[model samples]
Structure formats: C-alpha cells, structure tokens
Target: MQEQSDNKQPLFYEIIGPAVLKERIPLYEVIGTLREYMNIIDRSYLTLTGKDRLSKKEREKYKIIAYEFNPGSLHIDLAIELYEIVQLVFPFMMPAGATGLWDLTKSSYNFVKTVAKLRAGGEDPVIQEDNSIQSYIIGDNNKIMVNPSISINSDKIEESVQKIGSFISPGAVEQVALKDMEEDGISITEEEKRLFNPETTISEDTETIVVKIYRLDIESKKGKLYILEGMEPKDIPFQIIGDQAIGPYIDALKADQLKVNILREMAASLTGKPYLKRVLLVGFPGIKPNQGKLF
Candidate 1:
C-alpha cells in the first residue's frame, strides 16, 4: 500500500454564472454550459507509500471535506452541511454539457486532476506524459468537467443547512443522522494539507467548499471487475461490451435523462439564488442497493 505524497486540495470553478434559463436544455448542452463556468470541488489526501514493503504501501488519495467556520464559534450544524450542499450544487451546474455529462456519475478523479494541474502552474501532467494517470479521469482526457460530493456533519448538521440554504435552494432537505463516525484512515501529504485547508475554510480559505467524485459501478460489498479483461470468475455471470461489463451491478446505473434532470433542477435553484458563494461537488462510487432476500 504505497502512499501518494503529491495530494493537493481540489478546486471547483464555475464556468456559468448563477442564471436559470427558461428553455429546457439537453444533457450535452448543459455540460457545455458548465464548461464555460467551471466549479472545482474536493481536496486530496495521502493513502499509502508505494514502497511495496511496509505494513501498508500504495500512494492514493482519500475524500474528506473539512470546513472551518470559526472552529470554536457557535453555529447550527445543518447550516454547515447546507453550506456543503451549496458547495455540491455549484459545481454540478457549471459542467452541464460534455465534460459534466461524460464524467457524469463516473467519479471525481477528472475534476481532481484538473485542480492539480491548475495548482501545478497550469502545467497538466497529462499533457506532458502519454500515460499520465490523469488520462483516465473522465473530463481531463478531453475537456473540463465537474464532480460533486455530499455529506452532513451530525453535530453541525443544523447550522450547515441554514447557512447553506442562503447559497443553494431554500428548501428543507432530509438529513439522516448516523450513530457513529465512519472513520477510514486515509492519509494526507504536505501539499494536500495546504489544498484541503482553504477549500473547507478549515485552515486557509473561508469562502470555498471542497468535494470529490467517484464511480458508482459496483455494489458496496462487491469488488469491481473489468469484464473486457476476461479476468472475472466464470461464476460471476456477466457480459462485456466495449470497455464496460454488464453485470449484476450494471442494473443500478441511473438513467442519463434522470441524472441530467436532477442536476439541472439543482443547478437552477443554486444559480437562481445570489446569496451563495460556490458549491463543491465530489464524485465517488455510487451506493449499491442490497440484493438479498426480502423481509
């Protein structure tokens, strides 16, 4: 498990300003509009070192959105999460056309790569290297993209929502409270520390929210298999078409039209409101439904 030392805070920029159009737009058109107004979300963190030795070794990034609104200040928890919600919709609205649609529902890697390049003196590693890892990132391969993330802090849930409504749609969103903290020991590097801090208003910037996007291709308990590679177990029971494999998990893919609409409505609301600063949407693995025996 090698660790990635080059992690940095993700940036979400808006290509389109907050303005809703009366006409209904196609998915591609939405993506194109978002490209014009790009929004950056999510920050990077250390995973493991790629030494192939130690107890753990693999350089990767972890997703953790941290926002600091006066660490010791009094505020509503939901307001902060709402603030996070505002962060989520902002990015989705901008990258509505090609970039957004292409990377749509896939993952936030492309969005993260774009930030890395912007922070790296505008020198895209992918542009210099033919096999740059960033090439796999959805939007980076061709153009700018948007990725979104969602999370509600339990203790700060109330505050997050209220404050966030000021930025996003002023509606009541369902907030589910969890009993325990889902702690995953994701690592972070010096560079990532600098990047993550400002985006969440934790250490540096106070006006930005960070997000990460991921691919929702498989079930939570099921490991992913590249069907085209013919490496899956014969009992797995699946079919491969082009680069994607149609397996039990494939059924979960949300309809493109539906996804677009959901995003569009979100965009319209956030854009319509002028009280928000920016929304950071992070992409990641989609939640898989349980296929066990029904009760």
Candidate 2:
C-alpha cells in the first residue's frame, strides 16, 4: 500500500482466473519485473542535481526513457490515474477484503475530484472539466463503472448507434458509416438525417432526453486485447518498481485470465483445501467481444 508519487516508482499486476491458489503470480515476481522497467527509466530521467548541471548522455537517456514509457507503462503519477481507469472499467474487480474495492474507488475518485477543484481556478486545467462529465452524471466511481456495463446490450448497441447516427455537425451530409460522416459532403440516410440534422428546425416544444450508458467489463483471456477500430491497439504491460510495486502488481493480477487460474491452482496445491475459492471478474462488464468495435 505504498503511496504513488512523481519522485517514486509504481507497479501494475494482472490475474487471469480464480483468485485463490495463486503464487507463480507472486508479489515479488511482479515487483522484480517492475524494477527492471523502472531502473532503466530512472537511470535516464533522474535530475542533474547540485554539482551536475546535467550531462548530454543523461539528457539523451531521459528522452529514450520518456519515449518508452509515454503512453504505455503506468508511471508513478499515472498509477492512480490507471487505478481510476481500471475502476471505471470494472468497479468490483477486487473483493471486500480488509481494504474494500468500493472504498479504494471512492478514494481514487475523490483524489481526481480534488485535483479538478484545484485545477478549475488555475491558469490552465490539466484535464478539461467537461472531459469527464460522465463521472458527474454517474455520481461515484462504482456507479460510473456499473451503470454503463448493464445498459450497453447487443440490441441497444445497434439501436443507440442507429439513433445517434454519427455525432455530426450542421449542414453535413449524413455519411453511410461513422467514418464517412466525418468526411465532408457525404450523403446521409433519411433516418440519420432526421436524428442528427442540425438544419432541421425544431419547435420549442421539443423535450430533452437523457441517454444512459451501460457498464461493461468484458472478461476473457483476450479481454484486454482489443482493436482500436481504425487504429491498432498497443500491448503495454504494467511495470512496477521500488516501494510503489503493489499497485502495478495488483494491476497485473487483474489483467490476465490465465494468471488468475494459475494463482488458484498454486494456492490449492499448497493448502490442499477443496474450497479455497476466489471470484474472478467480480464486477466484469459483459461487453461482447466485437473485434471490430472500439473499446
């Protein structure tokens, strides 16, 4: 439970299957993996301090490290962010053990709120207030994660897609697909025109509607594996190092389905208990794996 900070390092974990009987998925193994990833990052990024006014080699190293860790590795500062993202994706993945998942989510959510509050008055807000307005509509973190999973269904997915009809702007021809809609001067379907035509004059009597999002945490060995629609998905593993290893270790535990099963098998092997069970995907979102869809 070491605190994550900019000056320190962080770690992430994944569990594939049953929670109980896990070990080859041990804490230290994850910590070791993280250490390797971080030491290299640190060796390059550490400050030039006191006498050392910064060396050319050090600066070059820092650039290389930054490039490697940029969007993939969960660095110290981003540990909490990643945790919040995980919670947003799966609200109840962790158990109500000594330290409850809800409480953890609340803590993380509050931390973001506090930062938002501080940022609101600053010269520049690091994160746009409206960027996460969905969090406000959903209230707490757990609600944000759960509501969307249940609300999104196969039937509704198509319905909503059809109803929304591409989030286009005024005077735009409705395109056949979302991508086509983005292009200029594309023709739209009648249904799409009616739903999204900004030019259509509406009477003041029109009523507002609230669209609810369904919570989903699609679980499977390939659950984490997703296609980013037109783009490619990056396979970035969590790297944990130093005192902040726990977070990444936990993340790694949550990532792989087979890892969880291995942990359970190991636990059973050691304890010989017939009922040492642990729930997997405690709050998994049931988004069907539509390989073509954007996660």
Candidate 3:
C-alpha cells in the first residue's frame, strides 16, 4: 500500500473467496460492493457530523479516494478527505479554517467495524458515561469514540448491510473485510449473512399512542411515525393495513400530534432494541373522514 500522511491512513477492503483467487473479480460485483461501501462511509460521516442531509457543496467536501489495488484476493486501499471549511470567529476577527477530518476518519472506521460486529450477532459496544461508544480496533491500541445518539441513520446503515449481503448471496465472494492500513478489521463471512435478517414479531393486541407523522407516501400506503410519548420516543416505519383508505388520514400528515390505535410489529436487534415495523392503524381519534373522498 502507498504511504500516507501521519493523520491519514489508507482504508483497505479485502474480498476473499474462490472468485478472487486469480486476482480478478466480476465487474458487477466490484461495482456493487464498492457502491455500498461508499454508502456506509457516507452515512457514518453524516452521523458523526450530526447532520440530517448534506448539501450539494458539502457532499463534495467529503470523499473517499481510491488509491491502490493490489493482488492477493483483490485488496483495495482508499483514503478519506474532508476539506476544511473556513468560518470567522467574529466579524472583526480573521477567518479560521475548521477541520475535524482526522477525528471523523477514525470514527468512521470504528463505526463500520461496530456495524459489522452487530451484523455478526455481537453485543452492543459499551457506551461510556458521556454517551460515546468507545472501540479499540484501530492500529496500536487506538481508541475511537462514537456517539450513538448524535444522528444515527439506522435505516441507511441497515440498507447498506443488506445490499452487501446480497452481493455475497451469489457465492462468488465468500467473505469481505473492512480493514485499516495494517489490515486490522472485522470480517463478515457467508455463514454470518443470515444474522443480518431482521427478526420480526407482530402484536395481537391493539394499542393507543400519540405520534407525529414524519413522512407518508400516499400511493405506496407507507410512511414513518415518530412516537411522541411512550417508553422511548423513536421513528418507526409503518405501512397502512386492512384496506383503510389513507385519504381520510391525510390530515395526520400535517398535524403536530395524533392519537391513534395501532397494532405494532417489531423487528428485534442484537442491541436489545426492537425496531418498529408495520403498524396497523386501527383508529384515528378526533379526525373526521370524508366519506365522499374515500378511495
């Protein structure tokens, strides 16, 4: 691998299997796998920066540059760069460039490693009293701190895991590892792919809760809800069920608070937190349905 600066370390991805034995992998597999890998890094960066979305200019600020491709089972080295954004401390003060690229880089690597461990049925990493998840997977016993609550895009992270799993489904690639410059990283084998499948359970009883609709697709009859009051308020994906016309509940989308009875379906995770799945909306309190507009 090429030598990088002190603050920079080339991230390597090692794909191992019979297909790569000859130092060649299918073009489609390489493209698809690399695409998802970039997505993982992008999402992790967003989480660490505490941003919901990156602007067009900001997207260009963060990038993963591929530098070298080696033999020995198709090893690829990548470097991440985050450009400095200059901001003036005061109107009368000179502009100062702010950069956390080094910290963000290390945290991003630790984030991917933690995700891999979670997918392999590992326990949730220990969260410190300050709410940062500390991991010791980097070179020479380096500790990386990741704050779980900053702005975790769990759905995006899970999607990346599923996509990576699909790429391995064809059996060409038996396993993949995300490693640092020294090749210290986590591996996800074919056998452990099944662990990424979410464990879902449906509740037979109907329950009432207050929630706020974050997004709703009228045609797909699918949406997301943010629980306002309950055990722990969180965003959960929900699909309308039982042929109830969604037209009546269009107002729910604009409402600040909604009281609804629903049948909850939850997906269990190794982290002990059950993800909310399909929610059957049984009743909407205080909203009058327009009979004439029923679809």
- Best candidate (score: TM-score): 3
Comparing 2 and 3 on lDDT, the stronger one? 3
Residue 129, candidate 2: alpha-carbon lDDT:
21
List model 2 lDDT by residue over 157-244, tens digit each: 2222223333222433222221111121112244443422222121222111111111212121112121122212221111111122
Sorting all predicted structures by TM-score, with the top scorer first, yields: 3, 1, 2
lDDT tens digits by residue: candidate 1, 142-183? 443222231111111112212222222112111111011121
Q: Which stretches of candidate 2 lie over 4 Å from their true place?
A: 1-130, 133-142, 145-295
Tell me model 1's lDDT, rounded to 2 decimals.
Answer: 0.22
Better candidate number, 1 or 2, judged by TM-score: 1
For candidate 3, write residues 1-295 as lDDT tens digits.
Answer: 5455532445777787777765466667777777877776666566556565667877677667788888768888877655544221211121112223323433444464454455344333332212433322222223334344212334345556667766675447888766666655445566445555556787866677898986665644666677797435755667666557677568888889878877787766656666554576766656543333322
Query: Which candidate gets the maximum lDDT versus the true structure?
Result: 3
**lDDT of all predictions:** 0.22, 0.24, 0.57
Candidate 1 regions with alpha-carbon error over 4 angstroms: 1-114, 117-188, 196-254, 259-295
Report the Cα lDDT for candidate 3.
0.57
Error of 1 at 153 (Å): 28
- Could you tell me the lDDT of residue 246 within candidate 3? 76
Sort the candidates on lDDT, descending order: 3, 2, 1
